[model samples]
Target: MKLISLLFIILLRFDGTTASLVKESSDKNTVYVCGSGKGKRYHLNENCRGLKSCSAKTIKTTREQAQKEGKTLCGWED
Candidate 1:
């Protein structure tokens, strides 16, 4: 029973740590920018330049949405 409990705790900790790492990596990869005459936008992996800066938000969305919203903004192709 003790070994089982210990294993469970270790597994839980591992899972939580991995989850946080993934989230951090995702945020690091995401970027946002604004155009000279455009509005704010987000990009996954692109060099963006504009008046506005970029950041990561708690709200989650799909890549399609990011591309759609950031169309006016700038981004790196690969």
Candidate 2:
């Protein structure tokens, strides 16, 4: 019984931590990218000047996903 209670407390703490992390990640996860372009940078703003030369569609994606696809932050990004 004591072990079960301890496990429950641990699970609650983990869940709270995970929730906070997810919230923080979500706040900054969304970023803009160019689809099918020679450029390999992600922009924080859709209207960034760097995006002006994009030869493809502007896409919204997670920052992590963009990095996974070999993209880095745009030089024009703040």
What is the number of backbone collisions in each predicted candidate, taken in the order shown? Answer: 1, 0
1-78: candidate 2 lDDT, tens digit per residue: 999988866676579875554544457878889887566899877778989988889998899999998989999886
Off by over 4 Å in 2: 1-26
User: After superposing candidate 1, which stretches have Cα over 4 Å from the reference?
Assistant: 1-15, 23-39, 43-57, 71-78
**What tens-digit string does per-residue lDDT give for candidate 1 at 4-64?**
9888666765798755645555675454443332444454433334322534322334456
lDDT of 1 at 4: 100
- In model 2, residue pairs whose N, Cα or C atoms come closer than 3 Å (at least 3 residues apart or on different chains), thus clashing, are none
How close is every model to the real structure, measured as TM-score?
A: 0.29, 0.61
lDDT of 2 at 1: 100
